[model samples]
Target chain A: MPKEKAITAEMLTKRFGDFIAVNAISFEVDKGEIFGFLGANGAGKTTAMRMFCGLSLPSSGKATVAGLDIYKDNEAIKQRIGYMSQKFSLYEDLTVKENIRFYGGIYGKSDTYIKKETEILLHQLELEAQANTLVGALPLGWKQKLAFSVAIFHQPDIVFLDEPTGGVDPVTRREFWNMIYEAAAKGITVFVTTHYLDEAEYCDRVSIMVDGVIAALDTPAALKKQYHASGMDEVFQQLARGAKRQDN
Target chain B: MKQFLSFVKKEFLHILRDKRTLFILLGMPIVQIIIFGFALTNEVKNEGIAVLDLAKDQSSGELIRQMDASRYFELRAYLQNEQQIEKTFLKGQIKLAVVIPPGFDHQLRHTNKAQLQLIADASDPNLANTMVNYAGSIVQQFQSTIFPQQQAAYQIQTELRMLYNPQLKGAYNFVPGVMAMVLLLVCTMMTAITIVKEKESGTMEIMLVSPLVPFSITLAKAVPYLLLSIVNIISILLLSVYVLDVPIRGSVLLLIGMSILFTMVSLSLGLLISARSSSQQTAMFISLVGMFLPTVMFSGFMFPIENMPKPLQVISNIVPAKWYYIIVKSVMIKGVGFNAIWKEALILAGMCTFFLAMAIRNFKIRLA
Candidate 1:
């Protein structure tokens, strides 16, 4: 039997008055797959992800997140999916443990479940000593890791990360990917959007978007071979060079 | 319900963790109550005055003693000559000088007429008016006692009685105004800043994407401030009653109910501001300029609304603090019950509903 599809978008389009931010984009991600959504500036990557997370309404077309319809079941879709943005959503004034408890509480998780999961998560992150410290006082790398842990603490089916590794050092970025791989191994699909071409090579399959449309979609190695390029970087440059929209 | 409680707890923690903001939030009511109650008052008492009694007779001594006995005036100096009156006023210690002419008892017993000159410093017109009025009343009283049945026919003796606040205490006026000002500052400005800070920090997006609805999130943010405002109201009432000697003449329960209603209106305004503002500074600016200034200017606390221009008088009707000030004065000073203030209460409830509806609509359109 074929694997279950975690997300399926058939010609999803979003328009902002006279401007088309996401124009009839089609894509699919299987369960437990690491999907890379690569795009240049102003290529509508965030706009498309917002629709999947049920934070924005689509102008036309159909999409389902975790087998729930985006239109009729927006709230239900939210329950089955988790989201973390580049903005760092955790409260800086709240202690690390308090942040976990707050996110868990909002998801309607019972106290016992949160208490048990919090200890295990804290131990795993090696942040047991800093559990009572304010999230603001922690280093940037630790804060990012803690934020990712909190995002998936409710055990959602899929997690959407928007530029989660934007300003981190290379070593920390590698460590962050290790955490992402661990989550993917547990059957939680990862749908991440980034502009870092090197990060595209770590994904199971990659899709490059240009001018509100996906230009190419395939495995990273297959995309390089098909474009007759040396690496994913060259392939991205070749696809993005033809774009009329300059980086905003 | 548990989720809502957890969210409210987090809000309280946020308030308590910031030491500077926490100090400001809790300290503002106490400081304002003390300042407005004792230091800033309009009731004039113990003002110094100089007596220029040229008569030097028994009648002059009697009148001078009467003026000095009254609480409004203190006999500070006894001027020796007519030139000393100008010198006394120029020194600024004497606010008024009473001049009893030499005609003395001869004119009063024979002609049944007497004249006295009251020279007052008009630099502060309001204070001068009040002092003159008090002095006139005292003289009239002395005259009535002296000529009990010797009044001429058809002398229309107007019997004046000051109802409610006979003494015209300034505490009775400003205590209620202070309540309105403090509640608006605490409930509106703090609530707006708290909500907008989340937006600036990006937690608002995460909140919208959560399973919890936007309505609960907004309500949770307001709940902590609602409780804090109640605490503020209690502190202000305590200070006014025990320290300032301003009593709650009406039912205490009724006064608190109306205060909570006003608090809800203020909180709804905060919600409206937060929904429209994208940054913390913008929220603070809007709250201060849009809400706080109107509360101070139009509430008729610092300035009389009737004295304002025709257009401004009409605009004062829209300010929620004006209605609240009226309600508080009625309940706290006049000792009236709900029957007297139902209209103002209904207006506040309507404003609360209107602001809350607008805020929810804007939140949906902007965030969703």
Candidate 2:
């Protein structure tokens, strides 16, 4: 039997006045898969992620995010899918514990559950001593890790992370991936966007978007072999060099 | 409800930690009240006057005495000539000059018609107007004493009483304006900045992605600001009543009710600005230059609407602060009940509904 799908998009498209951001692109995310959406700047990877997270309305096409229609009841979809943006979405002025508690509370987590889970998460990061410190004082790696934790605090059916690990040191990026892997292991579907092509190797499946169209969709091995490239970086470079779109 | 509480709590933390916003939140109302109370005034007290009394008779002496004790004038000198009167006025030692002809007593006793010329410096128009009125009233009082039962021709005995502001303290006039201004600053500028700051930081997207509806999200963001603005209202009222001696002449309940309505108007204005702006800098610019400039210029704060030109007066009707200023003045200064101010109160409520609907509509489009 085929695996359960968490998100389904058919010809999903978005336009800004005359500029088409996300062209008609169709894809499916499995229930427990770590799907990587790869693209260069303004390739419309973020736009697709926005549609899945119900942040923007699709100019055309249909999508079911976390098994709910994006158009008909996106609010219902919002409750089942967590989201983290390119910028650090947590309030920097709030303490580490405060940021966690606030996100947890707003997501309808029981107070007792938040208390228990917060303690466990703080211990796992060895941040028990700094729980009361504002997130702004934390180093880039710690803040990223904490941000990812907050994004999944609700334990939604799926979590969409748009450029979750940008501008971090190599070691921290690897550690952030480890956390992502850990989350995926718990049966939570992870749909993430990143420009770091090397990170694409870790996804169960990868899709390359060029000018609002998904040019390729397959496992890393299949995509690399089809493109006759040694790695995802080479495939991305070849596809991006052929694209006719550019935006910041 | 729990989610809203947490959202509000986080909003409070954001506001309390931001030093610049915290200063504006707590510091502006007190400073505005104190500044308006002491520095800006229209009352002319102890203004110097010179009388060129040629008669030096009983009637002129009594007229000078009455003017001297009226608390509005200080008798500077008894001028001798037309040159001395001009010199006294030019030197700025006296704001008013009274000229009594030599036949003043003879004319008043025999002809029953006397001409007393009053010359007031017109450089400062408001002061000059007040001084002229004060001197004219005193002359009328002097005439009344002379002709207690004679009923002089063309003499209309006028008994004037200034209602509400019995002493005509300028502070009474501004207390309501200050209240309106403080609420506008706290609600419009401050709320718009905080909301746009969330959008700039991208935290608003995170919250939107949560289960909370956009309406609750905006409302939750506003709850803390609403509470802070209320605190500002109380502080301003206390400062106005106790420190400045400005009385809340009407029912305190009506005054508080109007304050809440005005604050809601300000909050909706802020929501409208926040919906239009995407960055804190843009929101601050729009909120400051957009909301406040009109509020101060046309809200009847210092410039009375009745005296403003027709177009400006029409524009003033659109400013919610203008209505609130009128309502507050009527309730706090005029000592009027709800019946007298229901029209202004209705307009403010309608504005609150319109802006709120616009904000919600804009938010829907953004989400879409």
What's the TM-score of every candidate structure?
Answer: 0.94, 0.90
Where is model 1 chain A poorest over a 10-residue stretch in terms of lDDT? A1-10
Which prediction has the highest DockQ against the true structure? 2
Q: Residues A70-174, candidate 2, lDDT per residue (tens digit)? A: 888777887888888999888889999999999998988889999999998998788999999999999989999999998888888899999999999989999
Docking class of 1: medium
Residue lDDT tens for model 1, A1-48:
123789999999999998898999998999999999999989989999
Identify the runs in model 2 with alpha carbons over 4 angstroms from their true place: A1-3, B48-70, B75-94, B97-117, B139-156, B308-312, B365-368
Can you tell me which runs of candidate 1 are displaced by over 4 Å?
A1-3, B76-92, B144-156, B306-311, B365-368
Estimate the overall C-alpha local distance difference test score of candidate 1. 0.91
lDDT score at residue A90, model 2, on the 0-100 scale? 82
Model 1: per-residue lDDT, tens digit, B269-297?
99999989888889989999999899999
- lDDT (tens digit, per residue) of candidate 2 on B256-303: 988999999899889988998888899889988888888898888788
DockQ of each: 0.64, 0.64
Q: Residue B85, candidate 2: how far off, in angstroms?
A: 5.7
